[model samples]
Target chain A: MIQVIAFYLFATLTIAAGALTILARNPVHSVLWLIVAFFNAAGLMVLAGAEFIAMLLVIVYVGAVAVLFLFVVMMLDIDFAELRAGFVKNFPLGLLLAIVLVCELVLGIGAERAGGIQLGTPDGTAATAAGASNIEAIGALLYSKYLFLFEAAGIILLVAMIGAIVLTHRQRGGVRGQNISRQVARRPEDATVNMQPEVGKGVQL
Target chain B: MTEFFQTIGMTYEWAWFVATICGILLIALPLMLAVAMIIYVDRKIWAAMALRRGPNVVGPFGLLQSFADGLKVFLQETIIPSAANKGLFLIAPIITFTVALLAWAVIPFNSGAILADINVGLLYVLAISSLGVYGTVIAGWASNSKYPFFSAMRASAQMISYEVSIGFILICVVLWAGSFNMGEIVEAQKSHVWIINGFVANPLLFPMWVMFLISGMAETQRAPFDLTEAESELVAGYQTEYSSMSFALYWLGEYANVLLMCALNATLFFGGYLPPLDIPVLYLVPGWLWLFAKIFFFFFVFSWVKATVPRYRYDQLMRLGWKVFLPVSLGFVVVVSGYLMYTGHFA
Candidate 1:
């Protein structure tokens, strides 16, 4: 009974938050609303007994991705009036896309009703062992059956990260970067030259 | 608990609810008291280190000092900036305070005495700790002030930077332990199945512990990694615009997080509620006392570090988290997992 209540609550909240994410005037509030949607969706996942996925959703999307959104949205000096100016111009195209997407979703649901799709359910061999926890179950499949695919996914992420770093990195001639090794290696004897004739002259530049 | 409640002429669901609320009060009340006492202790130790008297007049050797400070802060009027986002400004500290306490639900206080003995306890801790940054970030942004905004930006970046290294370090420990369950992790330390108990039993894990310690410090935003609240730089960082109980909440939450890190240090590496050695005689003493002793020891170590180390420069801090700790922790994760695989530990 509690589970049913929780499911409905999360489902309602998730939908409401999703609507708010688009309807909110401020981009910052929109991003925050998106985070709320993600959180409620995670709650839904938890209710579905996918604890690992639920935690991952919270950790990855709400924790990291939404924080990035908040960071960017907070820093931006965007004019909301100017943003809304394009709404009517793009409304027809957006409406068409939305209708097509909704049709596809309806078709997908109809197809699913006709012939149910076992989404995210692991294969027989890699199925969760009896009494094993959710994490262990996922790991057993991920590490063994889908190892190569997982590795490929990791490599793709690595390449993307490298690309981002390389694209953002800049080398400026006048910019001074610290050389900690040389800094630590410096001794009073080497950096400070002591001479009796130093009194006659100020110091070496 | 539900059965107990049912036996007592209550409905099962209500019994569960009552049990949960009771459990919360059980942990929270003691935790609040610990915070109070620890604050006094922190002041005393820092004062002694700096050759100062600290607070001696409040109570017997400043026993009531924290309570006095809390009362004083509570009495002060909450000062919200005229231009501030009032709702978010109010919500930020509450978020921080709540998130800090929420992580404690999964922490194994003494054996199976945790509130929620879930499978992915460590993940829950990580998720909740990550949310802690949001409070500071929200507070900073909502203040509608320059220093606070800069503080929030610094805080978010610093937290994310260190979380990477911290994640890798946790992976190393998790790989060694072979489980993410807090109780199981502690049980692994008892040295039952493996050649030795605990990851620290192997010399390779020593460096990982060191890295975990440093990363834990950085993770909690304590000194010298407390760039978020660097008074000399950003003027109390995110809390610059906060006053009264809101500021108090941040203070309490920050300390609670520091204490949680200390507790994690004990639970993950130092055998948690277990005795230092696996001797039979030491089992006579209560486990909670052992846990308490370990927590206090780690807390002292935290205070000691704060007194000794100077705050890191902003660039230097970033360099350490990304260039140094990240690679080192990542390398250790690989090494630990590989070693485990080679030894047929997993198989």
Candidate 2:
């Protein structure tokens, strides 16, 4: 009963935060709302006992991604008045998209129900009784059954990394980039000069 | 309803709730006080190492100096920058301070003195500690100043880099112990004779411990890795514009994080609260005392390092973290995992 209440509380906060992220006029306020949404989502993940995922949400999404968003928004020259002008123009299209998205979600739920899916029901009570914790069960499945899928996901991420590099590979002159090989190969004498001033004003030493 | 109430009354669940609440409060209050004292101790240690007298006039051995300074900060007016993001600027310190305190909930001071002895205790600690970067990042961004913003960016990058190495090293420890529960890790250590005693036992484990220590120091933003707060460069770094109690919260939170890191190091490597000897008479000394001793020892070591070593340059720090620590820790994890798998110890 307590778990149910806690789950509802987190879900409500997440939805509220998501709405506020869009509704807030100020960009910084929107980022703050987005952070709140991430936190509540992490809370929901915790309630589901996916501690790893919950941690990743808080540590990576809230800690890194949202902070990056805040940095970008703070640094950019964003005029709220100008941004608001487009909202009136885009309102009809936005409403249409929202309705279509909601309809698709409802249809997804209906299809699952039609397939005789029993959400949150155990396949077999004896499976849980077989001396494996949730983490262990998930680990077993991930490594044994879905190992190829996991490796494929990693490969896709690697491809995305290369693509990002290729897209943004620019040569800006003023930025001093590291040349490790040259640095390692150069001798100290080549980079530094031992200077002795000739004694023009005094005596030569 | 009467029967239900009676059954609820008869059960000890309320006692558990009350006990948990009291435990949490106790952890919070003392931890804050301890953090304050740690600042005084750190200053005194630094002064002593430099052959100078520290704050001695405020209280006995300058004990109340932190409190006096804290009061001064409390009375000072908070200055919010005119161009800053008002809401985020206010919320940043609170987020940092609260997250720092929240991590203490799962830390086992003694055998069973933790507020909540959750099964995923170590993972929870890692998760919560990693969230501290948000506070630093937000403070920098909200200030709308160049110094704080740059410092925050440096801090975010540095912290995320070291955290990966730290996590990999901790995975080696967890693989050896075969459990994420901290209590079980300590218990596992108790069953084995000290590995350092024999040459035949795993010699590689010590390097993993060293990796954890280094990564932990970096994570806490202590000296050598304290590029975030390098005074000469960034002018107090992310907290430059903060004043009054706002600044004090950052100060308190930083020290609290250092203490947390120290406690975690003790728990992971130093056999936690367990004393060195197994003598029966020594068993009477409660486990919490041993834990306190170990934690203070590490805290002293941190201060010593801060006073002794010069800060690392940004490039040097980054190189050490990624090129040196990451690969070393990753290799250590693979070796340890392979050993455990072959030995069937976890099975």
Candidate 3:
């Protein structure tokens, strides 16, 4: 009963924060609300016994991506007035999308309920014998049964990384990148020249 | 009504409540005390190495220095920068300290003494420790300062890079142990002659142990791998804008993480809480004592290194992690896995 209550509380907080993230007028406030939403989502994941996913959500999303979002938002000169103008213009479409999303989520939940879908729970003997904790089970499946899928996912990520690099590759004349070969080969004579000049003779070599 | 009350009394689950409370307290109290002692020991060790008397005035050899410092921090006002993200800035330290403490839940002090003896104990530790980067990142992002932001970016990149090699090394350990259970891993080691005793068939275990120790040192951001808090370069790094108790939390979190890494290193390789002995009679010395001895030895090594080695350059650190450690660990994993498979030693 307490677990149910805690789950409901976290679920409510997640929904509220997620809603506020989109609905807030201020971008900074929206980002803050998004972070809260992410945290509550992580809490929900934990309650569902998906600890690895929960941790990944917090560690990867909150730690890196959300932080990057926060940094960019904080540093950029964002004109709220200009940003808000689009919201006013697209309110109908936005509302339509929101309604559709809500309906889809409700439908999904209803479908699951109707199907009597249950998450697997291991018996104590099996758990002990197999050492099949949530993480262990997931790891076993990921490495063995779904190894190809896992590798494919990794490959896709690698492709995305390469794509991102290619997209962002810029050759600017003003900026200099380190040239290791040149640095290694350069001699002291090339770097410096000792010139001796006679005292009180400015023009003398 | 009297029968009802008796029935209720009979059904009461006081043990469950008591156990939960004890578990929480077990994690909390030692963590708090350890943090305090870590601070004192760090200063004393550094001071001694630098040829100075370290904190001599507080108590006997300044044993009470950490307590005094804690009190002072608690008394001091927390300064909030005007342009800072107030919520994240305020919550970052708590996140850091809590995450650091939570990783201890799976760490076994001795056989069957862990708060949670989950089968994925090693994975849980890895996951929890990885989450610690969030606190640093949040602190940097929220501070609205350039230095903190740069420090956070550098720290996140460094941590993520090192974590890959660290994970690889952990995989090697796990492969050898053939179980993720930390206790089982230690027990497995106990069944064999000490790797250092020259009677062992495994020559590769020592190299893996060294790799794990080095990776762990990097993961904890200790010298000479402490680019995250390179004072001359980053000016206190992610906690640059923090003050008083907030600053104290970051400090505590860092040391706690270092200790956790040391404990993990002991558990994974150096026979955890198992003493180095082949004599069956010497097993009477309680595993907890052995664990403590091993942990402190690693802690001493950490301090010794910090005192002796110069910090690596940022690029050099990155080069070592990505170019050297990552490839080596990856190759080691492949070789170990193949050997284990061929020998029919691992299932």
What class would a CAPRI assessor give candidate 2's docking? acceptable
CA shift of B192, model 3, Å: 4.7
Q: What is the lDDT of candidate 1?
A: 0.87
Q: In model 1 chain B, which range of ten residues has the least summed lDDT?
A: B191-200
Off by over 4 Å in 3: A23-36, A49-75, A89-100, A113-148, A169-205, B1-14, B192-202
In model 2, the runs with Cα more than 4 Å from the true position are: A85-100, A111-115, A122-131, A166-205, B1-16, B191-202, B277-282
lDDT of 2 at B111: 74
What DockQ does each candidate score versus the true complex, computed on alpha carbons? 0.71, 0.46, 0.26
Q: Residue by residue across B1-347, what tens digits does model 2's lDDT show?
A: 22343465633545555556677788889989999899999999999999999999998989999999999999999999999988889888998889889888877767765676666777788778778888898899889899999999898889888988988988887887777787877766663555321111336577877777778888889997899999999999999999999899999999999999888877887777777555566569898888888789989999999999999999988998999999989998899888878989777
Residue pairs that clash (backbone atoms under 3 angstroms), model 1: B191-B197
The estimated TM-scores of all candidates read 0.94, 0.87, 0.82
lDDT score at residue A157, model 2, on the 0-100 scale:
92
How displaced is residue A42 in candidate 2, in Å?
Answer: 2.1
lDDT by residue for model 1 over B256-277, one digit each (tens)? 9999998988888888888777
Ranking by DockQ: 1, 2, 3
lDDT of 3 by residue, A26-116 (tens): 6766877898898889888777767667767876676557756865675678787888897799999989998999999998889766765
* Candidate 2: residue A120 Cα off by (Å): 1.6
Give the per-residue lDDT of model 3 (tens digit) for B213-316. 77777888888888877899889888999999999998888888999988887787777776667466656889888887888888988898899999988887
Q: Tell me how large the interface RMSD of candidate 2 is.
A: 2.5
Query: For residues A39-105, what per-residue lDDT tens digits would candidate 2 score against the true structure?
Result: 8998897776666667777877876677678767866888778888988999999999999999999
Ranking, TM-score, top scorer first: 1, 2, 3
